[model samples]
Target: MSPGLTADDFDFHLPPELIAQHPPARRSDSRLLDAGSPPALIDRGFRDLPGLLRAGDLVVFNDTRVIPARLWGFKAAGEAGAALGGAVEVLVERVRADNRVWAHVRASKSPKPG
Candidate 1:
């Protein structure tokens, strides 16, 4: 099976303020969508789950639970004589084989290898 897809293949735009910073107040209150073959639609609360599933259907979940590995820091930019202040936001996605961390970083400038 082919594995890699370019970032352009899965592009999406979301407003910054719309992103949820934390989990829902109640897990069972979360909405679930059914995107199977026929694509059935339902708008019930999470408690209505057992009545929706069948015998052999698989239910996959993210087992790699999220840890608070994201950090917000700052960096200095511009030339040494004209160092401009900048903000940086970082999220540690996973640890790599070489003991380096794969991360998603947001800043005015791109990040560089240490």
Candidate 2:
């Protein structure tokens, strides 16, 4: 069996200033990195993507509107309800009909099952 991956496996250094705060003036003008052939990094525009596709290739699209879904709170110790050491960060992935949510949580420790 393969080893499990942790957040550290995907961690890398990226300067905040290098991140794009907004989309390009024209969406199609966005940058695309063509790395299909290794060791050769070709920089292309988003408009060039259609021509690079082959038959039977699958493409997934995300069109959902972005929302403010991040939440922050402290993890409480069981029964006594005392606050834990650090704050817990929750990124809500989805909300169900029952009002429960699916989220990605980050905490100093794993929260006990309630």
Supply every candidate's count of residue pairs whose N, Cα or C atoms clash at under 3 angstroms. 0, 0
Write down the TM-score for model 2.
0.55
Q: Residue 52: error of model 2 in Å? A: 1.2
Q: Which run of 10 residues does model 1 get worst, by summed lDDT? A: 34-43
Regions more than 4 Å wrong, model 1: 1-26, 34-40, 76-85, 96-100, 104-114
Worst 10 residues of 2 by lDDT: 76-85
lDDT of 1 at 114: 45
lDDT of 2 by residue, 19-66 (tens): 889999988889998988978989899899999899998989998998
lDDT of 1 by residue, 42-82 (tens): 55666677777899978787777667888987675556765
* Per-prediction TM-score: 0.48, 0.55
Where is model 2 more than 4 Å wrong at Cα? Answer: 1-15, 72-90, 102-114
